[model samples]
Target: MDTERLFDRSYERVLSHEVDGRAFFEGFYDAFLAASDEVAEKFHDTDMDRQQAMLMKSFYHLLSFYASNNADYYLDRVAISHNRHHINIRPALYDLWLDTLILTVRRFDPECCDETELAWRLVMTPGIVYMKFHYNRDSIVGS
Candidate 1:
């Protein structure tokens, strides 16, 4: 099956569950903070309301990228923004981020299933790859 179609179906299933976006992010942050003290410290001075909204938009952009491939623009920007010189989003953090997201999805998304989890993984792979590449590249340059 095509990736776009699969992602759309899974995304629709999640949305159809009628999960509140705000509440979902709150739960996600709770889980994420518990998973990593480093991640929590990074956000200590940040405004969560704005960050949550941006995270939702970024996820939607990631899902949409499978279809249009246009969302790759933001993906690149995200990679650049997370580089070592900026937010210093290391590869390990991406693993933690994905783990937290899946856990939160299982908690808040009533439609969560193996397929939904796979969709999230598949859809996020490209952006995560990009972020990891840039992080490594920046690390090399810094060294």
Candidate 2:
């Protein structure tokens, strides 16, 4: 699916709803903390309110990046910030992140469907891939 359609669905069905947005992030964080020890430990000291805000912004930025074509600047910074040497988000962890996000959407989104899930995946994949790619490169180059 194209990013424009995906963004439209994401905005109208998910992000634009205030209560669902809160529920979605709550579900995502709860599921993420329970998914693995590594994940749990990573966020043990983090400020979740701030983290959630950042996630929301980053998610929108991801969608906008695809929708606008020149808005990848934020995503590039996201990749750098999440690189292994910094936040240490590994490539493998992105799978868990995506899974939990989709599960959260299913649980919280009023209009959740296969297409909705696919749109989330399609919108999120590029950012995840970019993060993972830069994470790997930083690992190699920084070492």
Candidate 3:
């Protein structure tokens, strides 16, 4: 199957009863916070519940960017928000984010394998690239 098809199916499994709603996302955050002190410190004052909610929503936008091959308004806004002038998320942190997410996927998605994990990485790359691209720009494309 194609990358999109593989990712779509596997991602569904991640959200299914086996993993349960919110559990996978919650677990990802837990692992992410412990993955690196930088990550934990970055979110030191964050409201975790709200942050997890945002992450769940952002996953869709990231997939949309991969499927559409364009950073649409929503993704653009996200990139802008994460830009150096705003949240100041460093470029290297995106690598950690992607790695952490994939590992978390492996844990939550029992069906996860090399292909599925690669698909997740491939799918999230565009959005991560877009965010990294805007790290210095600090402005959205059509804004």
Q: Please give the distance, in angstroms, between residue 79's alpha carbon in candidate 1 and its true position after superposition.
A: 0.9
- Give the number of the best model, judged by lDDT: 3
lDDT of 1 by residue, 1-143 (tens): 35556556655654445345547677788789889889989899889889988998888776666556454566767777798888888889999998888887787666567877887788787767656878856432232
Better of 1 and 2 by TM-score: 2
Q: lDDT tens digits, residues 1-143, model 3? A: 48988898888887763344558778788888898998899899999999988998898889878888877777788888888898888999999999999988898788889999989989999889888988999477667
Clashes of each: 0, 0, 0
lDDT of 1: 0.73
lDDT of each: 0.73, 0.74, 0.85
**What TM-score, over all chains together, does every model reach?**
0.78, 0.80, 0.91
Ranking by lDDT: 3, 2, 1
Name the Cα RMSD for model 2. 3.6
Better of 1 and 3 by TM-score: 3
**Which of candidates 1 and 2 is the stronger one according to lDDT?**
2
Model 2 residue runs over 4 Å out of place are: 1-3, 15-22, 69-71, 139-143
Model 2 error, position 104 (Å):
0.6
Considering only N, C-alpha and C atoms within 3 Å, which residue pairs clash in candidate 3? none
